[model samples]
Target chain A: EAGVTQSPRYAVLQEGQAVSFWCDPISGHDTLYWYQQPRDQGPQLLVYFRDEAVIDNSQLPSDRFSAVRPKGTNSTLKIQSAKQGDTATYLCASSPGLGYSQNTLYFGAGTRLSVL
Target chain B: AQSVTQPDARVTVSEGASLQLRCKYSSSVTPYLFWYVQYPRQGLQLLLKYYSGDPVVQGVNGFEAEFSKSNSSFHLRKASVHWSDSAVYFCAVRNSGGSNAKLTFGKGTKLSVKS
Candidate 1:
C-alpha cells in the first residue's frame, strides 16, 4: 500500500511570493493532517481534516496560510505571502479515524520550502 | 491546552548500551502519549503509543516506552542500542476526551549512536 505522498519535494521562494504544497493521503484513511517543521524543531500541526471537513485549524496563520481538502482525499496548503520564517518542511499525514487509540498517523517525506 | 516536553535535546550512546529518552506532558487530564522517530530527510514514524492499561507499550525496532501517570511522564527505553537507531525522536500527546487526532509535539531529542 502506498503511504502519504507529497509533491514538489523542494521549493525555493522569495519573501512575498506565494507557494502551494500538495498532499495525497493513503487510501482508506479518514483523517488527514498538515504539519510544519522548522529546522531543529519537531513538526507542529497547522491544520487537519476529518473527511471533507476541517476539524481544527486554530494553529494556522490566517492572514497568509490556507488549506483545503475539498474532496477529502487530497489536500493543499497555500501560503499567499511567504516570509523568511516560513522556511520549513511541510509534512502531510493520515490516519484511519478519530477514534481513541485507533489512529496512527502515516507521514510523507515532506516538501522542504526555503523562503528567502 | 495539552503540551509535551522532551527535556533532552540530544543523546549519544554506543552500540550495545541501554538507552532512555524522557518525555513529560501537561494536560487537564490523562492524555494519549506517543513517540515518533524521524530519519534523515524522511518523515516521522510512530515508534510507540500509550493510552491506558499497561504502562509499557512495545513498538517497532525493539523499542518500548513506560508511561508513568504519577509523574506524567512517558519515557522511551531500549535494552540495547544499535547504530541504525540514530534519528530524531519526538514526544507527542493528544487530549483523550477531545479530538484524538490532533497532537502537540515536543522539540524532539536527536539520538546518535556510535559503533
Candidate 2:
C-alpha cells in the first residue's frame, strides 16, 4: 500500500512570493491535516479537513495561508505572501477516521520551504 | 488544551545498551498518547500508541513505552539499542473528548547511537 504523497520536496522563494504545496493522502482516509514544522521544533497544526469539510483552522495564519480539499481526497495549502518566518517544512498527514483508535496519522516526507 | 513535553533535546547511547526517553503531558482528561520516529529527510512514523488499558505498550522495532498516570509521564524504552535506531522521536497527545481534537506534539528528542 502506498503512503501519503507530496510533491516538490523542496522549495526556495524570496520574501513576498507566493507558493503552494499539494498532498495526496492514502486511499480511504477521511481525515487530512496540514502541519508546519520549524527547524528544531515539532509539527504545528495549520488546518485540517474531513471529507471536504474543514474541521479546524483556528491556528492557520488567515492573512497569508489558505488550504482546501475540494474533492475530499487531495489537498492544497497555499501561502499568499511568504515571509521569512514561513521558512519551515510543510507536512501533510491523513488518518482513517476521527475515532480514538483510528486517529493514527500517516505523513508525507514534507515540502521544505525556504523564504529568503 | 493539550500539550506534550520532551525534557531531553538530545541523548547519546552506546549500541547494545538500554535506552529510555521521557515524555510528559498536560490535559484536563486522559488523552491518547503516541510516539513517532522521524529519520533524516523522512516523515514521522508511528512507534507506538496508548489509548487505554495496560500502562505498558509495545511498538515496532523492539520499542516499548510505559504510561504512568500518577507521574503524568509516558517514557519510551528499549532493552537494547541499535545504530539504526538513531532518529528524532516525538511524543504526541490528542484529547479523547470532542469531535475535532487535534494532536499536540513535543519538540522532539534526538537520539544518537554510538557504535
Worst 10 residues of 1 chain B by lDDT: B94-103
Which residues of candidate 1, in runs, are more than 4 Å off? Answer: A98-101
Fnat of model 2, as a fraction: 0.76
- TM-score (0 to 1) of chain B for each candidate: 0.96, 0.98
Docking band of candidate 1: high
- lDDT for B40 in candidate 1 is 93
Q: Give the per-residue lDDT of model 1 (tens digit) for B55-80.
A: 99999999999999889999999999
What digit string (tens of lDDT, one per residue) describes model 2 on residues B1-115? 8999999999999999999999999988888999999999999999999999999999999999999989989999999999999999999999876786599999999999999
Which ranges in model 2 have alpha carbons more than 4 Å from their true place?
A: none
In the order shown, the candidates' DockQ scores are: 0.82, 0.83
Q: Quick one: how many clashes does candidate 1 have? A: 0
- Candidate 2: what lDDT? 0.95
Give Cα distance to truth, residue B86, candidate 1, Å: 0.5
